[model samples]
Target chain A: MTTTTRGRSDITRLLLTQRIPLLAVLIVVVVVTFFINDAGGYLTASYDFDYMSGSLISAVPLAMLGLAELIVILSGRGGIDLSVGAIVSLSGMIFGFAYGQWGWPLWFAIIATVLFGGLCGAVNGVLVSYIGFPALIATLATFYAFKSIAIVINNQQPISTPPIQELYSLSKSVELPVIGASVPDVPLGIFTFLLPTVVAVWLLLARTAYGRRLYAIGTNDVAARWSGLPVRDTRFKAYVYAGLISGLVAVVTVAQFASARPDAGVSGSGMALPAITIAVLGGVAITGGIGRVAGVVLATLLIVWLNAGILLAFVGNEGSQYQLLALGTVLVFAALLNGLTTRRYGGTV
Target chain B: MTTESLNKNDKTEKNEKSPKRVRVLPAPVTGQEVVLVGVIALLWAGLALSTPAFLTAGSIQPLLVATAPIALIGVGMTIVIITGGIDVSVGGAIMVCSVLTAKTLVGSGVNLGVAVLLSVLTGGVLGLVNGVLIAYGRVHAIIITFGTANLFMFLGLQIFGSGTVNGIPGTLAFFGRGPDGRTLGVPHAFLITVLVTAAAWWYLRHTAGGRHFFAIGGDAQAARLAGVRVQRRVLLAYTTTGLLVGLASCFVIAQGTSTLDQTVGSGKELAVIAAVVIGGTSIMGGRGSVLGTLLGALLVQSVASGVTQLGWRSQLSDLFVGIFIIVAVGADLLRARARRSR
Candidate 1:
């Protein structure tokens, strides 16, 4: 090949193999494009550092769920959890009852809610890992069941007692104790919920034997089984972890909304779609066994920033509609890119 | 040339002959189908005995009409799933189709044939988008459909603009529950669904082309080696589903009042999927029937109607739906396990 061809192939190879660099470049491009649009005096709201930092609030739940999905998809065997959003809604309701109605201590209520979420996930794990049900079918059934119970449990009325209403303070933006004045305040949930989950998941995946076993089973369960690995248990734990994270997210959503809405998780296309989209865009192979924590976090940042920019780019309800268009377009683009890369270079991010 | 060698040759030939005979198409009514029919019948009988008004035409007519759209879409979904693909975008596609058809009727006073044709063609176009991306792009069916579902919803909302499509003319009254919609006490929508389902049943069971879908789903590479044209068949399945979705959108419009809202098809995809899975169709693909899909849709609709008539909370009906799905698939799973053990 000529020198030019060699250089061009080198660039293509880097773009296909190293997903983080590609996502970073895309983020920069998006920011620059929005800045240009803002400079042209076309934005409804200012597109600046302050606005972008404030929009990081959405990223907390998104990144948390994205990490949750990363764990399950990493387990392989067509593994997935469609009921994450439903779990969020159901657990949120339980949290509402404990903290708001029953007036339990916040710490106790939080722990109970998380455990309830894990219990729900265990149901899915048992069905999928032990009972031999397809992950998609098992989660889907639970999605429906949980959603219905969430609604009927409270007769579709959202719980917004005095304690729950006070909990809204948890979602407000807060300044860091040091060097915080130099930057915009970040959503408090980022500190309280998202960061802990991210660090825990990263450590669990990176520095643990369980994580190694998960990757082993996801890569090839039969091979792992032949090697005497606890394949089913590992897979089951992945789902339980996903549900546990979703449960934590339930508290975050309740805090944000100041009430526990029964349909909070399942409204519209639901949280599962966006979370899965983030995982895929973060270079998690839909076929399973390959993904990263940093990649998911970066992908969430890119989307949250892009969406915030789009919200500024348009006025009124049009912005939200266009957000759908943007999300759909980006997802399709990423999915197709995943396919192309897998064929061209024999792998994806 | 001894007796033992001759006996071995005879046994080998017998084994080969038996496989060829057994690989012949499965029976028209499977164990799952019989069980589904029995369950539905028992539910209906119980409802009729407890509630004197359950068997009346006023109640039954609406139930059949409600079932028509789901069963119609379920037929196409049956084919798609058999080919190892799914179309979650059907809900969004229905919204686009119905909203467009309703708007056209209200805006231009179009006749029935033109309206139906317009809806179907639009649905075909949308389905074609999903088919091309999934088939040619080589991505998974679920992801592509999920993406398209959002895109189609955006498109539908853009068309819907301000709000509901109010004051739609009854151009589709022929498919409604009114006297004009029926011939011999059968609503036109349900009748049409039945005829189309029957045709699909025959095509899937008896045709070489239809059997290719099963072959492809069983193993795509093997089917390719067998000259199945897997991609084209998969694309055709989605496109066919789109066409059916278009027609079902019309049924949805007819069943409603003079106005159509933006939430027209919000969760219809799940309902159709529930119906298809309940019909004993394997999600892993390669085994299904349109006849069973029809029966499944009927059973689900009956449950919904029964729950309401029994003065239960309307939302509680979904609980039953969830339970039914578990039971239906669980029974099939047990049967497969039993077969494996045997």
Candidate 2:
């Protein structure tokens, strides 16, 4: 009990110390953007709000990715979802195609996509948990295999459908007062769309006994297993959950855009890897077991802020590949800072 | 590290003996690899038979020229994989080196040798950065290199814009130049690949650090406790990869006299990795050979080359490679499991 309290306080203290720099950066960026773009952009403009909200919405898929990954990482089995992006593309493609071509309902499409993601995730979990394949190689194989499978299924075609305006509005609500009208303030996507997902995820992760064990295993799988936790089941669940959310996110994306492109999330490195970066930058430990939902939220916001800043600043080239470059640079910088602090604390980064 | 040890390992294949015996046994090259090479050779022969143009001494030149960067990269990939590390940033590293070589030609105007040395050094540094993050930061090698890959590619894009370097063309031009159908009808790229292969073979077999790669791959903690400077060796291995990729970048320009776009090497690591595995290097790490990697590269390239000759959709190449990777890994697992049960 003493140890738990001590740890809680320690983390609190660290967060307290770090929060200043984080907020300071946030405020400075806000101020700088406000002044520089002052064609009356705002002491902050509501366009700023929309821009920030857009980043948050963009970050939503990544958050699902990060959370899904965070669970597996916490389970201490040392698993990574290398195929997450492929799965994302595949699930999104399938859901979009079924809804577009077969006229499936939104709920059905959502269920089917999430189920598909779960099945793929289950395959990975089984190979690692049962067949005893190495996590890295196994996931790597699935990563490629899933990609080819998606490509083969769709023949690289985009799954575009007629617009579903009502469904789209679910994720696209905003209340604007507009220079003193009825509404009190500006609105954002998180409040309209992702807040529900966030609340649901928080409840699932924090308010459940399974969540406790999920973290325990992440700290040390062997010990957890020996203590009678269903390491395999829990690990399997982590993948399943990741896949399910990926699927759900895909369906939401399709409905939101009313089109699911084959390249919806087809990057080589995979969204799972970058999501891990976001998670780590958010305060999730790389080695797993310790992290906070709030930290992840803050980190996601930070990423959005950085991206929007780059777009507004127009620093390097116009390609937006530079944004990817900056994103990676920020992640590395965060990691390096982690190493330095850990060393000072006599702790490993 | 030795055939003698290999046979001795096979001798330990008693029913009750640990499956350690199979670890020592020579992994036969796969059909994907063998078939791919056979196809390459057959394509050359068939083309020669079908078209008089194919036999013209200049016909194979393009093929050889194309293989230069791939081969140079194959060598570095062999090292990193042998240590169970994947350096996906090789393409980015090479791109950076390409522009650096070009920049030297343009901005620095250094001699060819110094420019090559400088480019190679830059590669080594990029690799070292990757190694430091992976080994010390405990981040997966893919993510760190992914970050660095982005960093390098962006830097390359910034330093050398999308345009090819004018009439100067930034390519080195000397190392890749060939005599008029001399040197046994092989392109300079082929010759370089062979010489580098020989060097890699000797290095893997002769050096203590070379042996440490396999050990670390086999089991990192065991290697660390075995008094190996595991991190330093990992750093060196990655740096070696960088040097080779850098060499590849230089030769690419030297051969073609053209600059590549930012995405030039973005996803080529997948092919090199697939080639390495098809050639019999375990994706699980700790078990690969220089010769095996060479065979793997040949096999992977054959898939690309042969399909092109056969007029098949090149995009299906991913499917073929993916299927082969799964089969190869599955076979390894089955074999390992069988040996363990015995």
Candidate 3:
């Protein structure tokens, strides 16, 4: 009996210290709770697999931007990019002007928007890595600058020309080719945009020399410098990568809205805040040098499903307000858990 | 020979003591503060030259009233940042306080003192919540505040019920931009801000408790070792910020139309932070001045006013603000480098 109790305690410790397991458990709890509620006729609509799959559309931009934050925050030295939302707003407008009004080829417009986003990120990189500004200050300044430019560039108007409107098909639900009869149809952007980006990011982080350099520098900048790594260059590239991701998210956002609103990325509480929240909730250390792409993806799923359930449980705007409460409560709870885990178990995995 | 040696030793001791005592206090005005004053003056002069109405009483009074809220909140923010913590929830706190206050005023038509007291108390309670979590929980200030910001916003929205609190009485007219809000030639709101800033400046400079904040920010462990009551000091910092946010919300409501909307304090956090940062309050903590924050708020508002007067898009002002932050922080970094080299 004593051995069994000790063994069970050990398993508990593992679940608490390893972020992936903890998040997985929470996701299960959220889904099961909503399912129970739905069965009891508490939900306004069915909390079925189809609804869950449909909700993944929101996860596209959220997960992408969370990954963007993951990259920047992993660069250490108080690294963060508060301007990703601004980049999305600005880059989406560029996409609007190019594809919607200027009548450029879709592929070319996409490339230009991504490049423009990279250029904006490069500005943050130069200020932070080269000129020695704090990542917070550099990005805060850029957040202002990019947001201003996005708003004023087009006289505060959205671009929803015919081509842009036609782009809405990108977000439509599509059945899987081989398993079409068994599973719910997922949003097309999952395959066309989110999946590709996630795979690319995962490959880059897991397989490349640059990825090792980034983690090393983030872990300890002085040690990395002593080891002859290109510390500044690696850090700079992180911001650039984040910008690139934001640019893609902008395209996803524009397509989802079927219009390039100047405030698409920044309306209400703003995209950057939610992205950062997801990153942190995914067990990304705010102090840097610790996080995973898988963690961010799972975090996105958890929030999206949780929010979907919340929407079903309440009426009208009250649902959204309750969503904020849930988000805040969960974040605070997770953060406190992180602190406790660190003290009791020597930090999360 | 023994007498001459003893006299020389006493002279050296006196010289060392005087300089060390002087070093304990920073310069009355730092280099950054001087530069900020100069920049504000130059901008004012330029605006006056470009637009005849820029320096007029009508433009200036409203500008001062607008600056008051940001500057007042910035005073608390300056202290918080000085202690190596930040309170981003002030915007949300402002929303909750203003909405609640506005509701009370609209519902029962309370007197000015009662309304002000209610708002400040509400803010204090919010601040206390932040302080308890941060002080005892041992979490990052930004993370905790970010969470609370969301919670407070939710609370604020719930208070708004049907979207807006319309037909609010002008109970806060004393803090408004109208003639009733002025005492002689100075706006009452601006005067109150100046008075508060002065008091905070004195407290921070002359009191040991104030000096303790800098000690905590510089190194919390070291401060605790030296008997600084680190947790208590940290709690005080955030609570003070809450009270100030409460006061600033009143100023905000006073300056706005009678209707209280959900957007009451949406982005005010960033605006106050910009003012604090521009004022030479280091984001890294341990060094800052409330007086500089006041001036920073003044400068940002002036730029906005100037932009409008020049017929440029109002949004263009944010771009200038971003540039100003870079330039100010860049200059500070350069100064630090020079000092290190020296």
Give TM-scores of chain A for all candidates. 0.98, 0.82, 0.99
Q: What is the TM-score of chain B in candidate 2?
A: 0.80
Of candidates 3 and 2, the better by TM-score: 3
- Least accurate 10 contiguous residues by lDDT in model 2 chain A: A41-50
lDDT of model 1 at position B75: 96
Which prediction has the highest DockQ against the true structure?
3
User: Candidate 1 chain B: worst 10 consecutive residues by lDDT?
Assistant: B1-10
Question: Candidate 3 on B143-179: residue-level lDDT in tens?
Answer: 8888999999999999998778989998899999888
Fnat per candidate, as a fraction, reads 0.48, 0.33, 0.68
Lowest summed lDDT window (length 10), candidate 3 chain A: A261-270
Candidate 2 ranges beyond 4 A from true positions: A1-13, A16-47, A164-173, A176-193, A255-258, A267-272, A315-322, A340-349, B1-71, B102-115, B132-143, B162-183, B218-227, B251-259, B282-285, B307-311
Give TM-scores for every candidate, taking all chains together and pairing residue i with residue i: 0.96, 0.80, 0.97
User: Which lDDT value does model 1 have at B232?
Assistant: 95
Clashing pairs in 2: A74-A218, A75-A217, A75-A218, A76-A218, B173-B254
> What does candidate 2 score on TM?
0.80
Q: Write down the lDDT that model 2 would get.
A: 0.68
Alpha-carbon RMSD, each predicted model: 4.1, 6.3, 4.0
- Cα error, candidate 3, residue B139 (Å): 0.6
Docking class of 1: medium
